[model samples]
Target chain A: MSNRYEARFSAVGGQGVLLAGDILGLAAQKFEGRYSLQSPTYTAQVRGGPTKIDVIIDDEPVMYPKTTAINFFLSLAQGSYDAFLYDLRDDAIVVIDPVLVTKWDEKYKTYQVPVIEITKTKVGKMIMSSVLSLGIMIELTQVVSKEAIEKALLQKAPKGTEELNLKALRTGYEEAQKLLAQET
Target chain B: MSSASSEKSDIVFWQGNEVVARAAIAAGCRFYGGYPITPSSEIAAVMAELLPEVGGTFIQMEDEIAAMGTVIGASLVGKKSLTATSGPGFSLKLEHLGYACIAEVPCVIVNVMRGGPSTGLPTAPAQADVMQAKWGTHGDHPTIALAPAFHREIYLDTIKAFNISEKYRVPVIILIDEVLGHMSEGMIIPDPSEYEIIDRVKPSVPPEEYNPYDTQYGDVPPMANYFEGYRFHVTGLNHGANGFPTTVPDICHNDEVRMIQKVMKDVDTLTEYDEYMLEDAEVAVFAFGSTARGAKMAVEKARQEGLKVGLFRAITLWPFPEKVIHELGQRVKAFVVPEMNLGQMILEVERSVHKEMPIVGVNKVGGVPVPPYEILEKIKEVLQHA
Candidate 1:
């Protein structure tokens, strides 16, 4: 695999998509000793508008921070999924919330993960869905190791929510592993 | 395990705006006065949180005008002061910026550019303010503006801005577009000894003998802080060596010329640029700020395609590196200027090269960045015509 990998996280403004990108970047740069960059689409509204963050993780220095092609794409909302689904590599791994995203291209490899449902039912917080999605993204891309993800996530987790966030991340990882086994 | 209290790591993923504030603190900037605006608010926010921790002060003033005024006021009283804003707020600060220019107060202003004629695109990135930065404050006053592309450069250049401002006793502006301001990246925090820190030269004479605008001490007179027992007049009008307003023809002429000459005479020392693979290249791409990041990639891609193209990325935007551009004009066959504006710095390039070679621009003002492929296509198109 090439040293450089670009991942995009998309959702509504209040959905914590940017925070997820930040955690992944922290994991790569601080824990994994890799270089990472993140650029987010800023919206005027505080909530309910489409927002996305393009993250690049590389073994070498990242010259151009903006992503031209995506290696891994995750979308938690239908509008963001539709708006940002264009520039994906041929073998790009696409992850989506099945309930939120109803449409997809059949030719592309797609994973339908119920991120919001999992966060609400298993992790006990709707906002934890972003962290949950980061787990799935890590399992698929391996951009940063699980240990690094835990260290970075716990560092960023809100007061008293470390165990809840870790539970959400571990649950997402296990679900993705089951999907990988089924694919084989 | 609470995020509210976490161990401090040596290196953290920081936004460009955040890094600017951290660097300002590291550079001994003790006062921040700013009116928060989109794409530049993070600088003010980070300063508000960190400045107090370091015994520095952060104040959110009533408006952009007051913000600039407070920064100038603070700087006059011996505090290394700073203020940040976007397009509209930058316009408001210009009047006071000129005041600081004439009064010879040392301060730093950061303009994190957003798309604008007036609040055109608050959250979108644009580089249209290139000319506005150089000529925004009115008159023919000298300007020193630094444009940094990445997070690390933002940190380094922000400190450099303070150094240049203190050393010259002139206001320095750091230009960052919305993309560079908001982008988050990894940057290693440098040790204090790794970079040179320059504070303004204090007046060596006694209080009675001190002159704020003394010309005998060469172009840059040793500055006296307001409360440092030296009382001197300060005004926006043309002033003499005593810092009082002057209407005398010779005194006015000499003072104005010196104000401009102090920076102009040192243009060679002030000019900082990146020349990538230009030694044997026939074409050069002139870019700055975030646009140069893509321009560098385009140069690499063109080199792989057997094209002789190089990138001249300007770190110092103002005092326009004319000498180097003139020298490069003699060697290169064509110039490709790509900017986020309709066309601003391209005019400077034309003036510097004196139209000696074919010059073209890949201009964009739609709040979208000019991608690498588009820049590469422009380079090829320019070469075909050349």
Candidate 2:
């Protein structure tokens, strides 16, 4: 309910990470029921390199679209985890793609998710891991409704890939449900 | 839209550049002259199309210099006219624009900024024009500028630009930028009962009693137009009140000093900004245009995580809003500036903050918004040190 929260997403190009961050920002607006302003800042590497996206959500008026110290860190690449080890909050909850980040430091206890392999093996190669990882992000926050996140995903994904992304999203969501049950 | 209206209306959603054109139309503007540039080209295009619709004439001048001259000439005949351009065009226009200021002609100038120094980035947004908008014109003359931070602010501020120009009988700049101009979103247009339109204060006394540059009341004088049944001399070479060319040394000094004093005395009313969270905070972000939107987000996210961050968005970027900035700088340990340019606004932030305090900048150039995490990193750094 506070007016500020900084969420950072890190990954490489083609990871659909930008799309995931954008959807969460949009969902935050819909969650507020006004024209919620979503200001995102990202890096400019065209090919393969560490790319980070920041999404800020608040109930009050937004003055600028940038922030620091991500409360939520979603790392879809090994580079993302390595990059964000120092960038996150002291107790920041990190969701990592276990396939990419095979190793983890003891200083930070992270949620290791086989996001890429599960997405590629079950959802097929044409789909991206970001869609699946978004399911975990939404499930974890519970701040935005699944429907709201889905609409944001539908609006953002490329022209022909929306359906597969949605399917991959559902598969990921079901996977998270199993994890939630196991933890409980 | 059948009949013409010289009426100012309430706030509404409109493109930043287009709002300048509408302001010109609402102020009884009868002439428009401009050379096109990105960000600001929309203003000229809108004027070219709509000016004729309102029974006014629109001219695309040869260059910024000619564009400025044409508007000045048009205004001399009692016409409210305007011109719109970007960084380079504005650079070409300042000399004549300065002439308009010294001559006390009523005209609106809109500069929709792109990145700069030279050509720079045509599509990128930058507020590098703030200081220039005030002092780019040569010599000491009163210049009024209004910067709109959103599409909605654009409409209201552009109308304010016209009113300020007409009320004082001088040139005013509708300083807008590329982000507000090109960004698109929709809103319901307002009905007519919302605005108070103003026109120049015309002289009601006899022609013989008039002094064009008289400082009797010391604000700005209302004299007859060149041929409005009264004769008045207009010159760029520093003239006398009797409508004749004057080279007298004291007269020149008085004329220059009077022009600047008029605006300087009323700078308080001209300055504008909107405060958020600064009423209770230890760190704040100062931003404008596209970068401001990003800063707003970062602040919100930081607060959710229990970090103390505030936002200060400048709706009117010119005149520098230094007082508000200085106040916040005194309370907050540091003021973070996030801008699209490499470091244009950071210089202003640094200038105002003035202490060994941490003044950070999250810059994004190459045509993209500054990412939220870049801001997050700075916030965390600030938090850790604190």
Candidate 3:
């Protein structure tokens, strides 16, 4: 457990949580040269129900792929935040969308970033919120290098949307930097 | 054979289903006929996108049965063919599965198993199909099934599945749990020189003299493709040396015996297993597919506490590897079989070892994987009882 870092990205289906988790896992393996496994759980319905993807990254080969101890977590909806906050280390970092997840737990280190709002105003696409949240999650946890995440994001981004997706990512990253600066 | 697709880098992150398609193409599989089904749908999707690029054919049939029948038809034409499905789809394909069996058609079927007696849990993982793969088809038929634990093994085994099917002229089933199907992980593409690729043995006799089921060529007859200028009868009925159906007691009996013997006689070569720290162990955990992941971690944790525990993973689920289990039972105090299904393969463990040692199963259903802690607890409990 100590050798591996586990994270869960959760939201309602079609929120791009799966894609965000996929890109993060890809970055961990392809760019950062670490071992990673990503798996998702969702309802049979195509959309609307809560969905979550669990990612485990380790230096050594990951023998057990599922999450035992979550090191970092991000929830983009209230229902997700309430349902999926489990098996976390005492000091696990939690990132949430302040607008979507109104309720909060003060026990763990939490960052209230308006990821959806950032995507709507700056990125101009609601679907890009997951990408923005990924930027904030990476910055808050520093699980993977910024360069690695950016590279993976560009590779996975749809054709003709690379520049827009990068903007959303940088905006969220800058927001995270500001939050860290305030703490300092 | 190599997964040399430009879309796949030397080392890349890929879903388990995606690698199956990649490996199939690399193994020279030229025809894919499958219906879209959850978990296993990615295999068809990848095959559809890549097969055309390789001059292969991808057909989406009306139903799972037709999907299977299409693969059989394609394979009969000498194209290495494949089909993939999960749960209910797998059940529907059984009709053709048996047809492929007695007809001696060489093709691969990938069943990314979801929870089910009848679509029990479509989005969940379960290993309940252990017996189904072996005995689902009516009448007695030889079965060769492979269960792979990791993404890398999925690639290697998918290739091996086709090779085994071709070598023995039998349908090979690859049983993958839904978790393994949906999970994405990193693996390096294997080099072409690293592995051997096997093709079916074609007949050298003239077209007029060729016999598809000629026993003179030994247990496995030299097969000639349908349109390869050698036209011979192929049917699910009991076949004689001349490839025609026979009702004679001796001919029918010999056909049935040879069908099963073709696999049983070569069990040693067909068996692929993984043993971890079994030497000088008091207990052994028998597991496969995704369940093996948990069992492996439990063994490691048990080892750290100085427990004499080990893991025996059955990569080849059918052709059950009973002899190996029988030998291990003699030395070990007990065997713990953990799977997503409730005690399906545990029965096989009981049969293999007889009553020589105690055998217990840690089973679960309805989506969640059996955690390592649960397996560890069982190991401890079995040790105390043993």
lDDT of 2 by residue, B1-386 (tens): 12112111221224456655776676677798988777678788888899888789999978889999999998888788888888898899999888888788888888877778778777667777767887787787776777666555666676777777888877888766676665432222333356666787777677778778776755688856778767767788888876478889998888788777777767677778777787777788887766676676678778888888888887666556667677778898877787766676577677766767888888766555676667877887886786
When just chain B is superposed on the true chain B, each candidate scores a TM-score of 0.97, 0.89, 0.97
Displacement of the residue A36 alpha carbon in candidate 1, Å: 1.2
Best-matching candidate per DockQ = 3
Give Cα distance to truth, residue A61, candidate 3, Å.
1.5
Q: Ten-residue segment with the worst summed lDDT in candidate 1 chain B?
A: B1-10
Q: Candidate 3: which pairs clash?
A: none
For residue B96, give model 1's deviation from the true position in Å.
0.7
Residue range A1-184, candidate 1, lDDT tens digits: 1267899999989999899999999888888777789999987886998889999987766767688778999998899988888778999999999899998776679999989988888889898899999999888778788998999999899889999999988988988998899999
DockQ-wise, the better of 1 and 3 is 3
lDDT of 3 by residue, B296-346 (tens): 989989998899999999999989999999999998999999989889999
Give, for candidate 3 chain A, the lowest lDDT window spanning 10 residues. A41-50
Worst 10 residues of 2 chain B by lDDT: B1-10
TM-score of each: 0.96, 0.67, 0.96
Clashes of 3: 0
State the lDDT of candidate 1 residue by residue for B221-268, as single tens digits: 999888779988899998889988889999988888888899999999
